[model samples]
Target: MAGCGAGEPGDVRLADGGTFRQVLGLEIPNFHPYRDQVAAVYSTLLYDSLVNVTPENKVVSGLAGKWSATTTSAEFTLRDDVTCSDGTPLRAADVANALNHQRDPALAPAAAAALATVPSFTADADDVTRTVKIRMAAPYSFIVRLLGTRPIVCPKGIAAPADFEKVSAGTGPYVLTGYTSGGPYRLEVRKGYHWGPDGARTDEPGVPAAIVLSVVPTPATAANQLIAGDVDAFYTPDPDSVRAPGPEVTKVEVPAVTGMASFNQRPGRVTGDPLVRRALLAAVDPGQAAAVATGGKGRPARGVMAPAAFCSGDTVSANRPAHDTAEAARLLDQAGWVPGADGVRVRDGKRLRLKIVTFATSAQLRATAEFLAGEWKKLGADAVVEEVTVMAFITVTQQSGDWELALGAGVTGSLPSDAVPFFSGPIPPRGRNAGAIDNAEYLRLIGQASALPDEASCPVWQQAEAALVKRADVVAVAETTAIWFARKTRFQVAADTTIVPTSIRLIRG
Candidate 1:
């Protein structure tokens, strides 16, 4: 094994009647649906949405038994027998509360941003049927996809912000049992749970009775645990490097995770100058840097979303930047920046410099920042890397003047409309537009695409994507694969998201 860990997760079960344990490098800040990745994973188990999208982009029913829509509104008919983990029957009012919570302008920035396309929600029910109607401010074509991302929580959570992370009152298969700040977060499976999308059931054979999430902190250590059979599964930086040389373990490639670097293009900033942004892009090859960052395990990115995404196409390929250090220097010269004696570009007593804010928790992203900094140096630009916590990274990106460049990764959705907040809108603390992009044509095209049906929105979406690539608001670096090493688990991970708890099943030895 070239880069494999030294130990293995022995074929053994914990005392709690088959608890599936997984490792995470960072702690989830909150268990709220939109708080973080861990929260999203947890929400998948603890909550159910009105609908779910299949890997093939098909709309499927989750909590909702059936649904229909028009240009300005969508109607959902809920299952009569659905119940939360707490044994309370799920009500249409709960659905209304969840949707309104996500779109509430006064709270939850990320969630609010995601649901910005929807303006209001109302719930009505009779003795035979519970129905919820969602009213869109406009004709949002991807309303189903947008609703799929939002998991409906109990009405209690709507008023209590802390309850989202602390309480377990969702109509899903799992209930949050306990959580600690550092490690060993736990969830216990609900019994007799028959209301699952695509006919999934809780009593299915090999379904773990409980799931335990632990913080491993080190990738190699977690990999070693997987190989030693001390852990059932774990994510690896390079799947090829971690699997044992036998049939006991297997590797799964997860998709739709993309690494990117966004420029803070606000006025009065160095990156705001289009020439500087272009020169920085011209100086380094994102593909090469991504290779080094992921240790050659990732696919070079083609666009904002992975190619597998429904909206991805040749528009991304058509706008990729070429690597040319000479052109980089020439661009700097044309922009009135001249190289001084030390070979660093200077203009009006200010050096041609940039600071890229990256996460300290991710070794790959940090390495990417370092590699890009080296490449910028070769082109007579000074690039400084600033490593910070995930919480700090979010704060820096949302605050103006706090960052020049940001290197990070984002999860993709089944629909392209899911990305509206990041690329459009006003800059925070007003909106989720961290890059401060104000392209009127880009905004117009996105609006046009979002208003049409999915079948008719392809060309408009492509043109809108072209605007992003041409403007270089956020430069896509790699379509990073989530390399999962499994010991005795059998499951399929979605191309759009890494974790799929509903699909996990233990392998019989």
Candidate 2:
């Protein structure tokens, strides 16, 4: 323990060569970035993107040393020294084809977020120049940020993606050497590796030589391990579950829009009507639901994008409907849906019914769904709750298109453009826009914003977010400051709590 070194003066030195242990909390079903959007969870551990963006929209070097972008096209010159985990030199063609493979929506359904920004795009690699050129389907304001962060699968994994279910392929500092279903994942540091964000190197003092990831089911259990010095770090929305952490522990609160009332706007659904959507949003007390979701440790939500987003503004405060059940009753009554004998509204002989669904395994998420249902029931609606696994979430929300509202279904990211695909693109099966939101004004503004350069497009982008909130199409109630606890380790994370793999440093006594 005495071999470890610390960053600041007056602190003990932390160790240089030890395996950093962590309770992943989240599931890692696959490592193939194209197969699922969740693939980005552990992506930094085994893959490196072309470039990285800071909280202020500052573009930094990543796998690509240099790059340039415009409204409809961009190019990245890969680092010549980069190599795959298998020890082979990474080729521009291999990664370019990887980008092109996503052009087919069918092949990259889960990772369709890239295509969401631009409906179509083409990628070509120039071996001679070590350059990868991309042409977007339409004008895109944030092309660099989107394509830059996407992990590139090496040719080996790209050729046989199914193998990725048990293996990984990329040019990251760490290589996946051990894995199993419902077991700890093991990764070893790649010696002589570089190309990390902001010039992070593996051999740096205090950096771990290896990492061990285990899926701990409960927040209390994981937090206990962290405090006991048995684990390095863990994050939890319900921080109250953890006993008071001592001074040795570092707790970072990441503010993010975590509570949302996502209505299914598919044709024939009760939430399809904007009036009903507004009524539903007004009936539920955002403050109360948010409290239940985060164990009374949450603040009011600000907007669709987190505060870390460069263009994020207070869109919700100005656009959100005030909580008023009487207003809710009046809206439904005006729509000719009068309350029946049993208090359930009846519209043309149809009983008003609603179902809330959640894919989260946390008890807090399920409790939030129940809380929303109770509020809807008071509005004379037959409200029920349904819980589903993450694997089945897309199937229900996208393919089956059942249910009325989604509890844990809101989108969260660091850019205004990050919300476009989930709100505007092709609806489910074809895309992840399960809500089937058809806001012409929002869609039009997105087009205008996309054609402009970064900072110059903030006004139009903010207007687009207002359009969604004003319609009650996407109502966010609360912001949960997810707590990230660390002991003998140090690292940085995004607003949504995604860890910076290269930033991790394991400390010793």
Model 1 lDDT at residue 342: 93
Query: What would the per-residue lDDT of candidate 2 be over residues 1-509, giving only the tens digit for each residue?
Result: 01112345247566899988878765677767788676666787888888887544578998789999988899999899989988889889987888887666676665665466574778899999999998888888877787777788888887888887667888888888888777588889988877888677898877788888888867888978877888878877657666787778876666666656678999889999888888888897778877887778776687877766768788887788889999999999887789999999999999998988885565777888888888889899999988886557667877888889876634666778777777877886666678998899999998999899778889889999999999988877677766788787777776446777777777676
Predicted structure 2: clash tally: 7
Candidate 1 has its poorest 10 consecutive residues by lDDT at: 1-10
Q: What ranges in model 2 sit over 4 Å off? A: 1-10, 285-297, 359-367, 387-395
- Which predicted model would earn the best lDDT? 2
Model 1, 310-350: lDDT tens per residue?
77766655675678888988888999999888999899999
